[model samples]
Target chain A: MNAAFALIARDVRLAWRHPNEIATILAFFVIAASLFPFGIGPEPQILARVAIGIVWVTALLACLMSLDRLFQAEVEDGSLDLLVTAPAPLELLALAKVVAQWITTALPLIVISPIVATMLHLPADGYATLLLTLVLGTPGLSLFGGIGAALSVNARRGGALLALIVLPLTVPILIFAVAAVDAAIAGLSPRPHLFLLAGLSVFALTIAPFAMAASLRQAAE
Target chain B: MNWHRFASPSNFKRLSARIFPWAAGGAALCLGCGLYQALLVSPPDYQQGQSVRIMYIHVPAAWMAMFVYANLALAGAATLVWRHPLAEVAGRAMAPIGAAFTFLCLATGSLWGKPMWGTWWEWDARLTSVLILFFVYLAYMALNNAFDDATRGARASAVLALVGAVNLPIIKFSVDWWNTLHQPASVMRLDGPAIHPSMLWPLLAMGVGYTLLFVVLALVRIQAELIERRLGALVQARLSAEPAA
Candidate 1:
């Protein structure tokens, strides 16, 4: 447990030291969401209808963009070996990295989502539900994305391959998250969709760490 | 029958060779009968008319898509848990075949849907999940070959398969909850089949035929993979034995 916290702290500190990485991801999230209006026209109703989906998808893409560096830096600097060989459980360490990643990347995206939602003309009723879905769904993204990062860390083509591996797995999260917000915007109860989103996060949490650990062990081998 | 003995690559090779002929012959017989019955003997649907014939292929291929993924995951388990060389080869060999079946399912489904659902595609729950399943298979194949080191690729992809296995049920459930337009199970229901026997028989025959065909293809692919690995090993051995190049 202490080791997990230390791992989290170390990762957070490292991320803090390089503020540009976080800034870039946040910029990508905002810029990518803004591009949808240009692509499809700035019609308020059309933008409102697609606001949640656009935000969710662009956020997913931004998260994916950041995932390439998740373990690449560790692998290159040789700290991955130290982490693997440490007395701390690798699964716990894996979870720590995921948590750290969520804190650095997804959390910021979540914080900025409402502003993007507003710019996209999302229904006022949806702001809360959008934030709720982002909070619930982004961790699942990071968890599954961590598995992709670890698996592809040693691969020749990491970026495209990581997206290919991770995107399909994230379908459930995207469905539930978008549905929850859409339901809220339509004046329907978002509870059921929110429950499913939460369920997916829990499921990913339980399953992803061990997968990450196994893939890391193989990559480090 | 001692299973452990056959875990050895050479022994497994011999066993697969022995089984290949039987599997291939059975596949030939079943597929011939199935096609005959499906195309000629089976009654057309009351609602769909002759277009219902596509179900004979679509349903079986869809079943094979899921079945092959399940087998691949099981093979992945064998590879990771036992570090069985044959399991690694088998997993690598099965991925593309599974992807092909998944593609067949999607293509045939689209053909049937155009005449029935009046659209080539719908974001129906089952269809969407199956599409995602197709993507998963593609991802598995991509990951399996991404690395230069064969063992590392195998191990990494094995972990991925296991992760995908864990997600498959969730994806199925979530998508079903989201929305559904595709018909529910007609044959595998607890209250026996809802499909008529005239259609059922041919579909079942085709299902069996497809499974047998998969077995034959798998055996052949595994044999090829083993031989390829042996060739690689021999080349490596000769290169090492040559001293400074």
Candidate 2:
């Protein structure tokens, strides 16, 4: 547990030192979400209707963009080998990396989602539910993206391949997250959708660590 | 009989060679009869007219899509858990074929939909999930060939295949819950068959033919992979020997 915490702290600190990476993701989130009104015409009702979806989809893409560098720096500096060989369990360590990644990437997106939501003229009732879904759902994105990052770490071309591998795995998260907010907007109970979103996060938590560890091991070899 | 003996590449090569002819012949016979029965003998749907015949192809191709992914996942397990060389070869060979089946399923479904549903596509749960499955197959293939090292590519893709296998059912379930416009299953229900015998027979025949076709194609491809690896090894050996000389 201490080793895992140390790893997380280190990763968080590393990300903190490089504020531009986080800024780029945040900027991309707001800018990309803002483009929809132009593409679909500046009609408030249409933007309001589709705001939650735009937020969720752009957040997914931003998460993918951040993932390409998840392991690249570590691999280049040869610290990945040390981590693999460390006495701490690789799976625990992998979970630490994912937690750190989520904190660095998805958390900021979650923070700025409301601004994007408002920019899209999202319905008033959906704001809380949208934030709630982001909290519950983005962890799964980071978790699955960790697997893609690990698998593609050794590939000659990792960027596109990583997105291709991770996006399909994230479909469930996107579905339930948007459903919850849509339910809230429609004045229906969001409980079932929220519960399902939470369940998916828990499921990804259990499964992703080992897959990430295994892929990391292969890449380290 | 020691099944482990056939896990050896050489022995597996011989074994697949023996099975290929039989599988090919069975595929030919089944597909010939199935198409003949489907196009010539089976009656058209009262509502859909001749377009219902597209189901005869779409449904079977859909089955093959899921079936091939399951096999790929199993082969992925064999590669990762046991480090079985033959499994690695088989998994690589199967990815593209599975992808082709998935494409065929989607295309034929769209063709059917244009006339029947009045739209070429709908974001229906079944259709969406199947589209996601197709993307997963593409990802598997892309990951399988991403690395210069063959073994690394194989193992990395094996992990991906397993992850995909676990996610597919969840994706299907979530999408089903989200929304659905596609018709419910008529063939594989817990209650007895739903469709009439007249249509059921040809669909069954086509399903069997597709499976046999997959087997024959897989065997041929696996053999080709083995031969390529052997030739690669020979070239490497000759290069090394020339340096010494």
Candidate 3:
């Protein structure tokens, strides 16, 4: 557990040095959300209807955007070999890194979501559910995106390839997140969709670290 | 008589060369008879008329799409667990073929949907699920080729295929739920309501034919990949021997 904290602290410190990584992801999310109105007409009703979907999708994309560098820095600097060879469990360490990644990336997306929500003219009633769903959903995005990051860390042009590998897998989270917000707007019980989103997060948390560890070990080999 | 002998690449190559002809023959015979039965003899549906003929191909292709992914996942497990070289080869070689079948399923389904549903595409549960499956295949193929080192690429992709296996059911479930919630004016029949014996026979025959066809293509492609790897190794060896002219 101490070793896992150490890993998390180290990753958090590294992310602090490169604060632009988190900034770029947030900027991307805001920009992407705003693009929908121009592409389609900027009517309030239309944008309000699509606001949750656009926010969820662009947030998903922003999570994917930062995934490329999740392990590349460690792998490139040869620290991944040290991490693998450590007495501490690599899977535990991987989970820590993933937690740190979510903190730096997805957490900010959750924070900035309301501003984008208001900009896209989201119904005031939907805000609570939007926040609730993002809280539930972003962790799953970070976790599954970790698997993609580890698997493609050794690839050329890995960012684009990472998107291809990760986007399809995140469809369920996207669907449920949007559904929960939509249900809230419709005055229906959002619990079922929220529960499913939470379920997906727990599933990702359980499996992603081990999968990342396996892929990281293979890439090193 | 030992089954493990086929695990050896040379032995596998030789056996596959011999087996390909028979698989191909079986595929051809089944396809010929199935298409004849489907197009010429099977009664047209009272509801769909001639468009029902597309079912003979679309349903079978969809079945093969799912079957190939499942087999590929098993092969991926074999590769990862036992470091079985042949299983790695099979997994790598089967991905594109599986993707093609998935693409065929989508295309034919689109063609079938137009006449029946008034729209070329619908976010219906089964169609959406299959579309996600196709994206999964695309991701697998991209990951398989992305690395500088071929073996590492294969191993990474094997891990990916395994992860995809774990997610497949959840994806299907979510899409089904979404469809039920939306319930957009249901038009196309999901199970044919009641499949007549005449339509069912040809469908079964076509499914068998498609599976056999996939096996033959996968064997041929796996052999080609093995030879390609060997040739790459040989070229590397010869270049090292020449010593920087």
Candidate 4:
């Protein structure tokens, strides 16, 4: 537990030292979300209808963009060797890394989603539901995306490969998140969708750490 | 006489070489017979008319997509647990063939959907899930080739294959849920033995043919990958033996 917290703190301090990384991620989310209106026309109805999907998708893309960075720096600087050989359990360490990723990547997206939601003219009532689902869903994204990041850590050109490897695995999260928000918009109960999202998050959290650790071991070899 | 002896690269190579010709020939024969039965012998669907014929290709292709992935995951498990090099080779060899069948399934499904569902695509559960399966295949193939060292790439991708195996069930459940949720009247209804006995036999034959083709292709590719790696090692050994220039 102490080792995990220490690792998390180390990652957080690194991010704090370079705030621009977080800023770029947030900016990318906003920019990607903004492109939708221009591409799909500025009509209010269409904009509102697509607002949740656009935010979720852009958030997903933003997660992918940062995922490669998750292990790339460690691998390049050769610290991954230390992590691999550390006495602390690798799975716990992997979980710590994913937690740090959620803090740095998904947290910012959650913060900025409402503004993007407003810019896209989403109904005010949907804000709470959207936030609820994102809170439940983004951890899954970080964890699963961690698997992709670990798998691609050794690849020379991994961005497109990372997307191909991660996006399909993320389809369930996307589906449930969108369903919950869509239900809210349509004046229906989103309880089931939210429950499903929760289920996925729990499942990802349980499995991703071990999987990432295994992949990291392979990459380090 | 233990079967495990064949797990060695050299023995597997000889075995695959021996089986390749027979599997290929059987696949060819089955494909010919199946197509003949499907096109000429089976009666047209009373409702879908000629378009129903696409099922002879599409359904089997879809089945092979899922079947190949299941085998790939099993091979992945074998690689991870026992570090069997042939398992890794088979996993690598199967990826592209699985992806091609998935593409065929999607394409032929689209062609069939156009004349029947009036749209080239629908977000129907089965179609959507199968599409996700295709993505899974692409990801597996991409991850498998991404590393510099062959063993490292294969092991990394084997881990990935096991992890992504979860997607299969999610796709299945999502399709079932989506189907019930929407339950549209205009969708292609496939409930029971909607297909006649004659059509059924042809479909089964095609299914067998596609499976045989997959086995033959996988064996050939796996052997090729093994031989290529061996050749690479031999060349490296010779080059190293020559000393520094």
- Using Cα atoms with residue i matched to residue i, what is each candidate's TM-score against the true structure? 0.94, 0.95, 0.96, 0.95
lDDT for each residue of candidate 1 in B1-245, tens digit (9 for 90 to 100): 43332234677877887888899999999899999999998888777789888988988998999999999999999999998888899999999999999999999888877886788986666677889999999899999999988888888888888999989988898787666413453212212348888888888989999999999999889888878887777777678889795
lDDT of 2 by residue, B33-142 (tens): 99999998999977678988898899899999999999999999999999888899899999999999999999987898788677898666667788999999999999
lDDT of 3: 0.90
Give one digit per residue, the lDDT tens place, for model 4 in A119-210.
99998779999999999999989988998888889685788888988898888888888888889888999999999999998999888988
Ranking of models by lDDT: 3, 2, 1, 4
Candidates sorted by DockQ, best first: 1, 2, 3, 4
State residue B36's C-alpha deviation in candidate 3, in Å: 0.9
Which segments of candidate 2 are over 4 A away from where they belong? B1-8, B181-193, B243-245
Candidate 3: stretches off by over 4 Å = B1-8, B237-245
Q: Clashing residue pairs, candidate 2? A: none
Q: Count the backbone clashes (under 3 Å) in each candidate.
A: 0, 0, 0, 0
Report the number of the highest-DockQ candidate.
Answer: 1
lDDT of 4 by residue, B95-128 (tens): 9999999999999989988988898997767788
Q: Quote the chain B TM-score of every prediction.
A: 0.90, 0.91, 0.93, 0.92
Give me the runs in candidate 4 sitting further than 4 Å from their true place: B1-8, B179-185, B243-245
Clashing residue pairs, candidate 1? Answer: none
Docking class of 2: high
